[model samples]
Target: MSPGLKFIDFSIMPVLLGAGSCRRFLKTRMLRKMTIKHYSSNRRSNSPDNQYSTIAEIKEKMMKSFGLEPGYTTEPKSREELLKYQPKFEDLPARSMQDSFSSAIIPLSTDAVLQDKYINFRGFARLGRLLEDMDLFAAWCCHRHLKVPNLPEGVPLPYSIVTVLVDRIDFTSVSPNGTQDIRLSGHVSWVGSSSMEVVVWLEQVVNEEYQKITRALFLMAARNATNTAAAPVNPIQPANEEEKVILAGGADRKKQRQILSAQSVFKVEPNAEEQSLIYQLYKRTTPVEQTGQQRLLPPNCIWMHDSFQMSTIPSFPEHRNQNNTVFGGFLMRSALEISWATAFLYCKARPQLEHISDISFQKPVSVNSFIKMTAYVVYTKENYLQIMTVAEVLDAYTGSRVTTNAFHYTFSAPDPVTEVLPRSYHDTMWYINGRRKFKASRG
Candidate 1:
């Protein structure tokens, strides 16, 4: 979208490009079948009654999963019905802070567990949150062009749609009638539709409170793309930040380099294989509850290999500050480097790798934090790779978080990338958002 402009949605739903032309999307068959899958699962329960996860049950499971505070009973709303306004956020009481998922929390009691710092838990929660948000964001973007309107921004994304949890939650201090600064630092390394890879670093500050989120920014990079000699006639574009620079150089060689400055792949959404992954991932994993809403979490599993260690230093000197601390630009640089590296590692299995198209900073991170970064190669095909990464900023002294972020990257193989075919999942998501009724498979 004009190089710098981007669309940022706070909820999870499929994305259709708002700043581009859907007509351009119609000419290609492979583009028609692309889908972004971020999470993974194998077992799904078909019991209609079972799909309804109670807030109490979600609370029990979450507490066990991440040491998070217990669930609170908010006034419940009727299901399958759309909302006309924002939901009321009632204050939760101190007693509701108990660990609902204690079986999962059992390990935290051991000396080895308390001091042991693991980042996988954050990855799980981040994956769930990103998928939920993708559902909303993507739907909203494509709503108008497809004849479906989407929810306005700044509203509460339904608990039925998205849920969030941190690895080490502290409610004992913040629960009891006291104001505390709740630090949430986490990152989703590689994300696609339905799943993600993430890590959460958290700390509760007594007498400190979390600032409510108000806005967000999304970034995309594309320039390096290799089209197969079989279809060499089709136009190809760059996919990585570096390729973009090279493209610009080539374009500048001929003229202004305007064409090369433009992004190659124009959109991001859930593809068929990705959708299958999502369906399978949630098929059996227990869901979390909040305000009487049942929300699903990524099933506990090792989807990405632990090949890289978290780095707090920037790869280059330009990113360091006067205090020798990493700057925000440096953090972003590190994030992309790590994400590309992780994606490259996964692509090695197939002897191929692609680049990222979009990135978003949910919040700011700082220096002196032993950041735990994770990335997932959620969606891959013959030549392209789509990766999502999450980075959590932490205060090493107390293991508290500075903030959270989610990034979406698109890569095209030596072949062209594809788009998703629309279905019921897309329709139901729109129905809940009070959007215009869609009649076609516009995915």
Candidate 2:
């Protein structure tokens, strides 16, 4: 038996339900009774038994309840047919923040079976699964905020929502108990003509009070039905003083992102301070008596090239989303797992995840493709280790690869970790980038 199979007891035949059986139960009973109104508030209630429902299941039911379906243009045979369904930005009306507000509940406390699905081997709720939930929930909120006008009956929604970037995910409290109920709530905090910023909160119910565990900021783009062009989304205006502050924060984050992009190492040379730092690192790692020999590594230090871990994964259909591509959440989970492993190998001990930030989804991974993830320990300060993981999709025919995503994670080790030194100019840039992220995450 597989190690994970130990969590399940085959002796309890009634508790073990097949996928078809679970789907039937959800469709017949849960889907028929649950509605968005039931989940509009954060207060716990004697709601119907929905402990078996996943985020995807809940999203599907909610969309159907609202008389909406996955937005796709009917087999556009030509360019003219596709252009006919192109979305118009001028027609979309401005909306208030309250209009897009939403909430969801994962009743892990009441459902042992559901808890089993989210619990990790260490007994904490899996952060990757939570990430998947956040991505789906953010898209759901965006759909709620969108208001496309004048569509005929039986026609699907005229917009396709896609996650473009995860600006930051901060964990205020790590180690969420697997047996506790979790609440997810958020809204469209800011919006442009074609893009929107969603802020989602993950909280665990402790003593009947919701305690925040993680707060995530996701950037999503709206596209036309066929996802060929950008689609305009309803603008969001602040309804209260607090909301105004939130909106301003979003604008600041947008501006900050622009600044960072313009200052990327690939775009320009490093400033004097950064150059000085890189030279210092080079000197420290170089041998004083150079006889055309490799420098001896100092005690408690390892080269960044030596601190890498890699894995290859086949993009299975089960991980695909409505867009017929690999789900963003699945990619995030895989990256986290590999990064965690990289940190473990570098530290020679288990490391506790401090936070995750700047997870960028550069491209979509197609089903049946293979993903190659490479993780390296690029920086270490005191007991903190920063791991950077890059995910790329490989072309089977040409044997070339295109990067799909990049992930940065900060973990705390039990003891001071061995220092990771840069060996080349390329590795030096990664080291500097990691240092910047580590400092920002700490602040």
**How large is the C-alpha RMSD of every model relative to the true structure?**
26.9, 11.1
**Tens-digit lDDT string for candidate 2 (107-131):** 7777788888899887889888888
Candidate 2 achieves a global lDDT of 0.76
Give the worst 10-residue stretch by lDDT in candidate 1: 95-104
Structural RMSD, model 2: 11.1
Structural similarity to truth (TM-score) of each candidate: 0.27, 0.84
The digit string of per-residue lDDT tens for model 1 on 265-301 reads: 2223344554565565445333533343343334322
Best by TM-score: 2
